[model samples]
Target: MFSKLFKSQSALRRFYSTATQNLTEKQEPKTYYKITLLRSAIALPKRYKDTLVTLGIHRRMQTVFHPHKPDIAGKILRVKELVQVENVPASAVRTKTEQRWERRPDPGFEVVGTWKNKRWLLDEEGI
Candidate 1:
């Protein structure tokens, strides 16, 4: 009975290990850091707040991107509890303007002009 239990547990462990290996191997190497401040550093130690500033995070729930470098990783570790970090590819990087543009609501239709101006333009075109 003891031998049978050990064999089954060992088989299950092997399966899980291979499954984890496959998951890690299938992913591309991440080149960028996507860090978001989840919790506020308010009332925390000055060093924690300073680390957040060094990471360019000044507000809660704000996200910033940095290259995947050891220095940045160390800084992230310093405030890990107050922030969330994700690995991202270089192509996923965006500037502030691009990020803001993405948040804007899309207008349903294109507005060439009002009917009066559109009619005037149409009449003047001799069409």
Candidate 2:
């Protein structure tokens, strides 16, 4: 009875592992956008930051939008010496420095023994 129970448990574990592996094999595409800073507010008055704030761009690399109108273009051009402007899409917007990945230690410890016992165990009782 114990042998049969163990065999069934192993089969279920194998099925779960296979399903997880299949899911991990799929890849997804990512979208990007173009942006530029038209004004160089870095050396300008604090009011410049206010202007950028009004435009929804408060940070150095922040990107915002204005309708593609001549007036908007003119304003951008007027401040061109201070900032850069570019085409940015909604899909590309994310929190600053959000692309970083964290490194983690392996979840399993190294084992060296028979199929039933793990080397990390303190004693033959399986700890």
Candidate 3:
């Protein structure tokens, strides 16, 4: 019985170590980049925002990667009036991208629903 228990314990230890290794392996190394959102697409016509969106940027602070090319550099310069470009590591860029993707939806819907239901019920009861 003791030998069986020892074997089981060893199995458990191996399983735990394998699970930890799997977790570590799934983690992506971070990528960072210098980013700038060159256009005030918000102020420009919707076409500009659509163009920026096509380029993988949406909101004002949104950023996308472009290998340093003359065309990209030129676009950055044109948008320089609106955006502040900076050099950053690929890892930092990856972290920021992950963070933006992981962001939760706004709580406004739940808040409005609760408030409307509570207010309606209270009014109906003459409270």
Which candidate number maximizes TM-score?
Answer: 1
Off by over 4 Å in 3: 1-33, 43-51, 95-97, 101-127
lDDT of 2 by residue, 1-127 (tens): 9999999999999999998877754332222223356445877777765666655565665555555566566556656666666554444454444422223446597655655655545466657
Weakest lDDT window of 10 consecutive positions for candidate 1:
111-120
Sorting all predicted structures by lDDT, with the top scorer first, yields 1, 3, 2
Q: Quantify all predictions' global Cα lDDT against the true fold.
A: 0.88, 0.58, 0.62
TM-score on alpha carbons, each prediction: 0.67, 0.34, 0.39
**Local distance difference test, candidate 3:** 0.62
- Top-lDDT candidate index: 1
lDDT of 3 by residue, 1-127 (tens): 9999999999999999999987765553323335557446666767656556545666666666655567666666645566666654344455455767768567575432256469766767789
Give the better candidate number (2 or 3) by lDDT. 3
Report the error of model 3 at residue 110, Å: 27
